[model samples]
Target: MTMIHAPSGPNLEQVRRIVTEIPGPRSRELAARRSSALPAGLVSGSDVYVRAAGGAVVVDVDGNSFIDFGSGIAVTTVGNSAPRVVERVIQQLDSFTHTCFLATPYELYLAVAEELNALTPGDHVKRTALFNTGSEAVENAVKYARAFTGRPSVVTFDHAFHGRTLMTMTMTAKNRPYKQSFGPFAPEVYRAPMPYPYRSPGGADEAFAQFELLVDNQLGADSIACVIVEPILGEGGVIVPPSGFLKRIADACRDRGIVFVADEVQTGIARTGAWFASEHEGIVPDLVVTAKGLAGGLPLGAVTGRAEIMDAAPTGGIGGTYSGNPVSCAAALAVLDTIREEGLIDRAQQIGSKMSSELNSIAAATEVIGDVRGRGAMIAIELVLPGTHIPDPDATARVNRYCQARGLLTLTAGTYGNVLRFLPPLSISDDLLAEGLGILRDAIAVL
Candidate 1:
């Protein structure tokens, strides 16, 4: 087991100049073809045609390279096109592609599950099931909780971004792009106001009261099966709940018979300075859903929980055709090994602290930056109209476009669409981080 602190790689400018026009002429043609072939429903990110990527820089098809602060929306925690990931993926592909864990059980899948059980929060004996996407994992978690608790409803917080599936969409707070035309969503999924201290009514006490009132007036404790929440609201402006909020929720769930399910899809797998963000509050959710960075860049999702509850589903009740695919499991194993070997959890904290400090300094110079909040590497600064809390979505959009033109990749989040989140890979270099922040500062100043 050799330890590796990410290797020295290509410089920022060298990587950017190679990928010329962001999307270049050839890339635009390919995108046009994609538009014809793929449905418009399948939305795509900014058309930065990618050729190759390594460390903090991604080279587009036009040979221009750009510093990646987005990490494909936090999917590539170990960095894009990592050599170790490439080699392992190629080796796994050569060995086999997919055997479908349900049809032919594989060692790697179970191994990954075992690893997740040990790694995720909780000391009790735990069980895990794998899936292909965060939506699937979230849906399965709800199913498992209901089956286990014999309850009818599940509660989710406002402004939370779970996934785009029917059940997950119902769980999510946004409606326009994600749920506008996709509805008539799954029933019995309830939404409660999340504890966003910056805008929450009366702070923690009122937020707790609202949660309790919701439980009392609408969805009672006995009728609820689970309360699914993100440890640190990822797409909800990278909002960090005030201290004791999660603990109180856990206590509420315990007092009743509800399962506490932590939707760690975006905040887990060392993205928030810990192996799992739930650990930050010393809270152990009865069930934990994880994905995104779990398998480095590979598509993998897991639902891990107490053994009895997770096993509540009847025989043949839960399983996917491609659940626990071997190749994905292999990649996940490598990702876990890499995180531990490289001490990425600690690095996430150090990097996030540095980033937050720098951003706060810049925020002091601007009236638009109404708030700076988040935990570990999952940080965001909400933009608002000067002297008011009105969300400045237009300013956010402008900042995003400016970043793209200047060779930096950043993403916007929050219900009001005014938060700029930074989810850079924990493995990103210090110099790259500084340069990306510099670009961001320039963009903000000009805006």
Candidate 2:
């Protein structure tokens, strides 16, 4: 296995020289073209138009280097333009770009699936199907679950984000933006209150009760095919559910013959200090949805599950035209090799500890930081009114603007829109991470 090092070519100094302003003039021009050319629905957080990226810095079209804390919204774990990834992608391009697996199966696709089966939690014989996005993987998980169990209903947690596809949109809980006018969503999807320690009234016990009621009183355990949830809510504000929440959910799903689907889209591929978030609880979910970081920086998604369940769907019933594209598989293989060779999983743990301690210290100085919580490199700080815990979404907005102005890319999440999430590349330099945190602290001080 070869480790991916921050490329020596185009070093940080050269990167800065090329890109200087936040969304430099070229980026602004591109943004104007995008606004005129694309649909309004493809909204972006900031107008930082990127031209190139590697390690922890993204050089926008304008010639400025910004410490990327979002990782292109948690996609590029090994960092954009990871050496090994770029090399493999270039090699794949030389061979062939697209040979749809369903039409003409390829060895690389099977090799990628084999890697997923071996890496995903569980010693059981697992099967994997590759797709283009996290949403498609999630949607297929449900399809397999329903097909395997012959059950129609699926349960998802509140504040959960599955995808933009019709079935997944119904599974998603947020309404304002994701599901607003996309109603008439797929039927048979039910919502359960998430074990959000910050907002849940009676803690995990109450959440469990709600789950049981939804199963026994509303949908019935026998009728439900799967229980899907994000190990740590991603777009819902980097919320870490109670310690035993996942264990309880897994147990209930097991007893009821329902599949426990772990939506690890944003948390998978060593982002959470572990290969998979379920490892934190020592629980092996029936299905795991992986994407974002899986291919280093390529478009790849996967659903790895127990063989019996995965095989239930008839042959030719579950594949996509471009599922398991060869080039993405090559990139995924390099990603796996890079994580193992570079020891990134444990590094994520160390990075989380460093960030948590520093962020907590910063929080103590201000009353606006209502909560700071997360696992591994995936961390967040929720803003609130100084006296009351009422969400201060505006303050969060201000912090984002401030950070962007100072050559740092930050992201905001949470249902109430008051949370600032830090999804920096796991391989970010120590000085850069600390520097970004300092900038964050200074921004908070001014607010």
Candidate 3:
């Protein structure tokens, strides 16, 4: 098979170049400055500050280049500084950066909403409300559900990650850095069992049954306003639920008049080889929360849902001062256009097939790689102790460090922090991806 080459940027080659150490001289200087200037709470995965990035490669301050597999935590599906996104953002910036969409409405905001309504998973009449972050989108989604259904309770699942806001943090399942010491969380939020086939004792069927029991016994369906889930859990590890699990959950929500919410903050926008991950299950969520890849690197989030449910909130009930900044909206419009014009959804599937083949081959030879899972480019390898399912976060961390030292940018996930997740940009070239995977294999081999 012929390998596709990534679009080259000025002074940016697709190959990884480690001129200095992982945190080179300049990066170390910058890290010192960052430590002095910024709060300690803001943790970064890498100390190598990026000077420029395009396609699959990121150039650091000290002239080191790395093959990026994180995509800035799935924020840049189209790649950093994608041509169309930069063009649209520049065009919008030249015209007007921000007039505040709520105060002075703009066509770009409406255009973004229209595109989202049309692109998200559903043929029903849909409406969209924009926000600045995924957490805000999720918060608004819950509000819309409660307002529409007139119920206060919301149900999330085990190993689910909504966002970082108070309400969303409450909805999130992880307890450490995300929820520890965060004070009084919002009430009426309940947790259900998620279908994690790899580690489940009774398998997918029992997991689904457990979820249903949770809804029926712990929190009755009538009291629930929304059932929010990540079709493929992102930060809680790239845990793909069993086949038909999403459909069944959607059906249950529909039957009980509970609003079904798919938090596609990480899995949407062609990241999963589909416009929205919910489409994989043929399930149409009443409301879909989106961010990350929505604006191709800009801070933009959206809640697209059935018109009635979205409209149920009063006119001024759901917007922020910077809800849909015009510049971000323009970037999103370009992102949608690029996705269609570039056939990124197909590209994602191709990347996924390749990554799965390579990673599974490595897993076959590596006992520490307990499971290889995910769809499209959203892939992950859960590390465990040899010959057992026990998590090995130490191995996961070692692999991550090795990959970083070898000039390959990777990310770690899972509630137990034992999963290595890969979110390569959809535009990455096959050769670059192979090189990064080669580094990963070498790292695992050393273990």
Question: In order, what lDDT does every prediction score?
Answer: 0.85, 0.88, 0.90
Per-candidate Cα RMSD to the true structure, in Å, reads: 4.3, 3.9, 4.0
Measured by TM-score, the strongest candidate is 3
Return whichever of 1 and 2 wins on TM-score: 2
Name the runs in model 2 displaced over 4 angstroms: 1-21
- lDDT per residue for candidate 2 within 1-447, as digits (tens), equals 222233341244322333345556776777888989999999999877765677888766565678889998888887777778888989999999997887778899889999999999989999999998999999999999999999999999988988899998899888979989878889899999887777663588988898999998899899999999999999999988888888999999999899999999999999999999889887799999999999987889999999999999987888788777889999999989989999999889988999999999999999999889999999999999996779999999999998988888899999999999999888788888888898899999999
Candidate 1: tens digits of C-alpha lDDT, residues 276-320: 999999999999999999887788999999999999999988988
Arranged by lDDT, best first: 3, 2, 1
Candidate 1 least-lDDT 10 residues: 1-10
> Local error of candidate 1 at 26, Å?
2.3
Off by over 4 Å in 1: 1-15, 18-23
> For model 1, what is the alpha-carbon lDDT of residue 320?
87
lDDT of 3 by residue, 1-447 (tens): 122233344235677888888888877887888889999999898778887788788988777789999999999899888889988898989999888877888899889999998888878999999999999999999999999999999999999998888999999999988999996999999998887878874477877788788778878888899999999998988999888888999998898899999999999999999998998999989999999999989999999999999999987898989989998999899889888999999999999999999999999997999999999999999999999999999999999999998999999999999999999999899989999999999999999
On the 0 to 100 scale, the lDDT of residue 92 in model 2 is 93
State TM-scores per candidate: 0.95, 0.96, 0.97
